[model samples]
Target: MAAPPEKKTLRIGVLYEHTQMTDLAGVDILGNMSTKSVNLVATLEPRVSALLPLSTPMEFLYISSTLEPSWTTPDMFVKPTHTYANAPRDLDIIMLGGPDPAAAHEDSITFLKKASKQTKWILTTCTGGMWLARAGVLDGKKATTNRMFVAKHAGEWFPKTEWLDQRWVVADGEFEGAQIWTSGGAGCGESYVSNTR
Candidate 1:
């Protein structure tokens, strides 16, 4: 009998910040790609942590940005497994998200710009797209953010990229070394649901 080819393991990193829970959770959807071989690591800035609600008494636990932790709210809080400074440089995919466009802008740009150079794929949702734009990762790429927000403000921030309308998700071509996937608000998946019905 001939031997089968060995499967390649993918290292996936998801960026995290306070109040940016939705899109971070959305990153889990990527697990569908190959759960058995895909390793998902949530990355954060130095000295930063992700806080999430508790089941009893409404408490919160501060998880180390570089250690794997359990999640109290499966749908809301995703405990990080690494800090940006310590995350794997050979990540195959990187996901970016924040509660607002400006959150962690300056602190994350330097690291993001460097990581994007080696990452094979970049997936961003909502204002998370803004972080990639600010990092110049989206330059010369066609992408989209939350329509409500982009309709009024994205142009001022991403003048080099082409912003499109009338869609739930906009996929752009490879730039440098990464393929970019961006979507409207966190509710973008919902649009697919409506279309399917």
Candidate 2:
């Protein structure tokens, strides 16, 4: 019998804007559900999206239209690389965020398509959806943004996708779209439930 051909290693890229939007909210957000305060840690339940690789390494890539200071300061999950690394080749998964909302929307997509050949999974948070929509990723994928856009264009941009009014995390597309995840906007240096049913 003939032996099977060897499989190729999958590559993933996570590209985020240089700016990190500090979406504002208050600690008592639950009190004034309609209030979007600007000095509080919005309680957001971060949903983890698992990958499908057998043993591929996760690569975290960053991009900024502006000068984003290196975040070497440690907090929890990881320590800073403290150096520069190559793109596509290094990342197996891509996560994105910024100090501002428009940054994510303005710079995440075209860059993504340029590297889509190697990207296995593309994920974002909060207003990150705007970025994906610009990239045409959400052109036809079931996705959700925050209360703001959902009211304006969730159904319009992701025309090919099913836009749900309530869901903590949403995944659309199969295989090709596999691992594409989006979550609600975080407020005031933190994430919020924004999960209104």
Candidate 3:
């Protein structure tokens, strides 16, 4: 009998910005897609666990401005494993997540510009889209964000990107290489994950 094929691992870099707990939901679901689904089955049929690959489909590196730890929301706090200066350059997926409408700092914008070149997918939630715009990655792409917020303030922030007023999530570009996934609100991050490969 041959061993199960090694699972392909996706390296995910989730950006941590201030006051944006909802944005984290996007990466959280992707990171758990395999484990969460399989764990339940393994509980029902314990033998199945041994046959399945132990390797996770996704590996996450939380990237933030500091290693000192910070609050993402009123109730959520995260201690990032990697800082912008030290994060791996070759990332499979990069998520610009966090609270909406917050201005992207120079360091974050610089990192996004560099990472976008090598990253396959870029997922942004709520006002996180603003950061991508600042990085110039969404210059010609059709994207969406928190509808209400975008209507009021996004124009000045993301003038280059074609902002849309529609539903929860909108996607542009090919999934195999470079793609942008933008979700409206915090809860919509799940929709972004479900639609993506």
Candidate 4:
């Protein structure tokens, strides 16, 4: 038999919340070429098949001036979360997930350091990207976010990172103090691509 193709391993660190939205529609579902789609909640994302752990690791993190503790004990009791829990320090990838934006607010900067400090990629969706800026990983780098929020405020809040307003996905890179990726628009999430190659 012929030899099989080699599989590439990519560790993506995603930070998500409970109320945050997602983009899931496509050319057929949108009925238009510009419909921005997003799932209400996710971690690994259904699109990311073949990856271990179905539910994205969701943490009870807050992005604010004062750091707060996590309340993750409830997820184990809830079935909606698939009884999933957070990952240890030695996972292949780490993606933050949740459904609430306001609730994501906190002052804990250590989480970002611990998550993205030594991972292949620190990926985030929606407001989760906001946390990256606060973490200082995107400092002196470029990034983008969903158009739902005002650009002016987004730029002001994440001044260290460049605010990209393009209408497509933008991937800066994947490394410590090197690459920073951002989606141009949630609409383009359907045809998402990377700049790795």
Backbone clashes for every candidate come to: 0, 14, 1, 37
* C-alpha lDDT values of all predictions: 0.57, 0.43, 0.73, 0.42
Superposed Cα deviation of residue 124, candidate 4 (Å): 3.0
Tens-digit lDDT string for candidate 3 (28-91): 6775566545676789989767634652677788887788785678667788898888888678
lDDT for 176 in candidate 4 is 44
What lDDT is reached at residue 118 by model 4? 58
Query: Residue by residue across 1-197, what tens digits does model 2's lDDT show?
Result: 97645444333233433423332221123223322221121334222111111122222234433334433112212223322232443344445543333434343455555544444555555556656666666666666556466666665655665555443355643346445556555532223223210
Best model number under lDDT: 3
What is the TM-score of candidate 1?
0.67
- Which stretches of model 4 miss by more than 4 angstroms? 1-16, 21-86, 89-102, 105-109, 168-179, 193-197
Lowest lDDT 10-residue stretch of candidate 2 = 46-55
The candidate scoring highest on TM-score is 3
Q: lDDT tens string, model 1, 25-66?
A: 554444423423122221333222221110011111222244
Worst 10 residues of 4 by lDDT: 27-36
Ordered by TM-score, highest first, the candidates read 3, 1, 4, 2
The better candidate by TM-score, 1 or 4, is 1
Cand. 3 Cα-lDDT? 0.73
Model 1, runs deviating above 4 Å: 32-77, 168-177, 189-197
Overall local distance difference test of candidate 4: 0.42
